[model samples]
Target: MNIKGKTILITGGGSGIGLESAKQFLAEGANVIITGRNSAKLEAAKKLLPSLIIIKSDVENEEDAIALLDKVTSLGGIDILYNNAGVGSPALNLGIANDQILKNAVYEMNVNYFGVIRLNNLFINMLKSRKEAAIINTTSILSLVPALEEPTYAPTKTALSFYTRTLRKNLEILKSNVKVFELLPPVVATEMTANRNDKKITPEQLVKALVSGIKKDQFTIRVGDTKLLYVVSRFFPKLAFNLVNPKKIYASLK
Candidate 1:
């Protein structure tokens, strides 16, 4: 799809991938609106890219999601709805309190899974009105291969991957012009993992891959080593599991 002249709304656009994606979209001549829970971060993003339209809205809140949709639609209908907001908890063990796990689980599911569904349901028909439009749901490589460091986070992304696949198939069955794209990125150099020393792709690299993928109509856009993860998971499931699970290292030390 030609990204130029399209109106795009990206969630969690205050930082990392979202922020970089928004910047690139603006460069591509698209109108971009970014939403996030933190007003300060959103303000900072706006300062960096004065063309950006920032809305402080938490995806975890139904009210905020609804208000965001209305506000963006009023500005101009959205051609791309990029569901990119997500959260992660520290690696957990079964010994953690059940109540605490449950609490974190609920919040993660609400933001990562249910929130994407809600926005898509709210804006799908509006998207159809445009000549060409897309809904980009940000899942992760973890959705394909479980990551030991993010047990809770991985499951939520996996659920989102499932939902995005179904949504794409359903849209095709309806012969709709609305396209659904799933973005699966491996660990990237972002604020979320600033202290981590692992090899990671830059946000600029991700945005470049994403834009090229979209232009060519690649529905499942896997960035960086995520493509490797998909391959390993398909043919070497056990090896893939061991690679991502740090617990395997402990077992090796013994």
Candidate 2:
């Protein structure tokens, strides 16, 4: 897709991958607008990129989704709706039955999966009207192989991964102009993964790869370790599972 001269709206744009995406997209000559639930973080992002149009909105809220759509429409709409907002609950052992396990799963699903659907539904029409438009959904490598430490978080991404594919195929069947792109990223060094000692990629590297993939029309953009995991899981499923949930991670869970 031609990102230059197009307008893009990114969710959770205050920091991490979203912020890096905004910077890269803007540098690529696209008009950028960012949304987040934190007002202070939004302001901080605005300060970092003076040209960014920052809006405070939570992806998990239905009302906020509507308001965000209205606001984006008023700003002349967007050529790309990047559903990048996601959340994960603290690690908990799924083997031990606990009420908190269900709560955490619901929270993760609400933000990581349902929130993407809500925003996509609201903006589908607008995207279809555009000459060239796309929806970018960020699913994770964990979707391919479950992580022992991220029991609840992994399933959310897996659900979203399925949804993204189905949505893309549905759009294709309808011959819709709105394109769907799924981004599968490895563990990135971000606030969300700050506590982890896992090998990580910087947000800059990930977003750079994402932008390159978008330009090349790569619908399923898998970055870094994600690319390897995809291949490994295809053939050596057991090895791929072991790679993600290593002995160390399993021990940590206990």
Candidate 3:
């Protein structure tokens, strides 16, 4: 599907991959509206790219998601919905248990899983109206290969990946105009991992892959270690499990 002249809405566009992807879409001549929970961050993103349309919002709340859909549709029916909004908790990966895990789990599921489900339903009608409608869901390499460092984040992403695959097949059976897409991104240099020292791909690199995938009408677009994870998860599940197994380094959180 051609991205030019399309109206796209991207969740969590205030920073990292979403921000960069919005930049690329804007460059391609698409009307881009970005939503984030923080007004300052959204404003900063707007300052970085004055061409971008910023909406202060969060995907965790049903009301906020509904309002966002209405606001963007008024400008134009969203030709593409990029469901990339996600967040995780510090306790999720550190072998933490009990109350901490429970508290964090709520946000993780709220943003990672429910976020996509809500957006898909909210924008389904408008997306169907478009000549070429697409929905890009963001997953992670960990979703395929689990890691102790971030367990909650990965499971939610894995669930999302699972949902996207089935959703794609279901849509094809129904012969719907809306396309389901997933991006399994590996370690990227973003605020999401500001403290990490791993040498990962830049935001620009990921954005390029995203645009290319969208142009070619691909369903799953993965890059960097995620590509490796995809291959490993398919070809060598045993070895992949051993590589980043959570049980190994999980020092129980007191």
Best by lDDT: 2
* Winner on lDDT (1 vs 3): 1
lDDT of 3 by residue, 6-120 (tens): 9889999998999999999999999899999989989999999998888888899999988888888677667999998889777453443467777677789989999899989
lDDT of 1 by residue, 1-254 (tens): 89999999999999999999999999999999999999999999999999999999998888998898789878977999999998887666645466666777788999999999999888988999989999999999899887766768899999999999999999999999999899998889998878666788999998999999888999999998899989999999999988777565443322
Among residues 3 or more apart in sequence or in different chains, the pairs in candidate 3 whose N, CA or C atoms overlap within 3 Å are: none
Candidate 1 residue pairs in clash (backbone atoms < 3 Å): none
What global local distance difference test value does model 1 have?
0.89
Per-candidate TM-scores read 0.95, 0.98, 0.93
Candidate 2 clashing pairs, residues 3+ apart or interchain: none
Write down the lDDT of every candidate, Cα atoms only.
Answer: 0.89, 0.95, 0.85
Off by over 4 Å in 1: 95-97, 247-254
Indicate which candidate wins on TM-score.
Answer: 2
Q: Model 3 TM-score? A: 0.93
lDDT for 22 in candidate 2 is 96
Per-prediction tally of clashes: 0, 0, 0
When 1 and 2 are scored with TM-score, the better candidate is 2
